[model samples]
Target: MDENSHPLVKAALIHAQFESIHPFSDGNGRLGRILIVLYFVQSKLISQPIFFVSEELERERLRYYDLLNGVRGDQPDWSSWVLFFLTACHRMADKISTKLDAADKLAMDGLRRCQTESEKKVWVYTFSDPHTTVKKVSTQLKIAPSTARSALNALATKGLLYSDKQTKRNKKYVNYDLLGVLT
Candidate 1:
């Protein structure tokens, strides 16, 4: 906590030490990764707890373990471990930025293509509630179920949403374009 260094380097060192200690019987890895975010947030490096680095680490699982192990070996190699953590953080941030931008563009395009007020409402609702049915949208928007169904179908036709081939009794529509960018 008193380290006079960059937050990323400090977080890397803290994580490495925590892993080396291996305090818990399980969930040590998950908890160690979470410590990085908590440190960042408490240090005011980030205003929110959105800087998640676990996915990046998980992607390079072998290398991540190797580097951590290297740091804990007879001759500790802190440099490689810190560098890998920083690199993973950079890549994760870039990936998040790209996905967010793409999803925003898709949302704006879908809104422009909406034909009616109901369609626009349904499209907007999909942002908050990705999964919706005709009945759900009808209740949420206080619109006729038929009108909700029409708007959903129109969105599906526009390629903004996709409907599953479920029974006609209970059909579901999703904003696949936005979900695609996000997922």
Candidate 2:
């Protein structure tokens, strides 16, 4: 299980070995999945280490455990594991692609609506940091509190941001669509 081998082969081997080790008292399953994503990034298979596994593994939880056990029992079950990995990769790729497409569309629409450079910067900042308060934005952008409030209110009016009315004067605003994009 040297990592210097072919990345796909190494990923499969390391994943199996990690499961065999069961190193952590808890979160071994999660750690193993994280290792898979990290391996993908380290091997340059993915530009970012953002792929997820919980739902995919949960969908086939029984079979996943069975395959791991089979491999531990010295059975030749690598092919099954490889197939499962490919299926997970496909699912993750599709999910991320859809998200990127939607984000791009939103960016284009937002850009078209934002006329000034400052407004465009505000939109970009909000998009990047969703669920932030006006105070935080003001502090980050070094703008006056009033200016920050105005920018946020304008975005909210355009249906790009929403907020839960907090009792405090410095209320928190959430980018609802951005959160939706993330989850």
Candidate 3:
């Protein structure tokens, strides 16, 4: 924090150090990854620790290991490791921001087409989990099971949700639009 370094670069250095030290036997790797987000939050680069880098790290796990190991090897390749870390951060931020924008637009569009408060609540809840059942929705929103089913049906009619299977009991509704946004 005292050095005049960029927050991302500083975070990368801290993460590399933690992983190299192998501070704990059980959760050092997980805690080191979480520290990246905590650093960003504390540095005021982000208001919340919501940004994620773990997925990208997991995808490039082999290369990630090599990079971390490189720093501890005979020839310390700090530059390459820092570059990889920054690239992962950039890619994740862009992907998450795009999905958030799409989800916001879908929420607005769904709300505009909703007819009742229950429908709106169900629609919003669907964004949290696009695949839901009437029982789950009813219990979560404190509405009757019949009312929840009606809301699900109404959303299905509006092309916002569809039945997952042709079953008589324990039916599931899926919100394709929200799913698309998420994926």
Best by lDDT: 3
Candidates in descending lDDT order: 3, 1, 2
lDDT scores for all predictions? Answer: 0.89, 0.77, 0.90
Better of 1 and 3 by lDDT: 3
**lDDT for each residue of candidate 3 in 1-183, tens digit (9 for 90 to 100):** 438999999998999999999978799889999999899999999998778797788789999999999999678999999999999999999999999999999899999999999899999999877889999999988999999999999998888889854686898999888878777
Q: Which of 2 and 3 is ahead in lDDT?
A: 3
Count of backbone collisions within predicted model 1: 0
Error at 78, model 2, angstroms:
0.9
- What C-alpha lDDT, on a 0 to 100 scale, does residue 16 get in candidate 3? 95
How does model 2 score by TM-score? 0.82
lDDT per residue for candidate 2 within 1-183, as digits (tens), equals 664766767776788889999987999988898888898888898787777754676688898788777776645687787678667667867888899888878877887887666567677888778878778888888888888888877777777778655545777777777678768
TM-score against native, each model: 0.77, 0.82, 0.73
True lDDT of residue 121, candidate 3: 95
- In model 3, which regions exceed 4 Å deviation? 1-7, 21-50, 58-66, 73-79
Every candidate's CA RMSD: 3.2, 2.6, 3.5
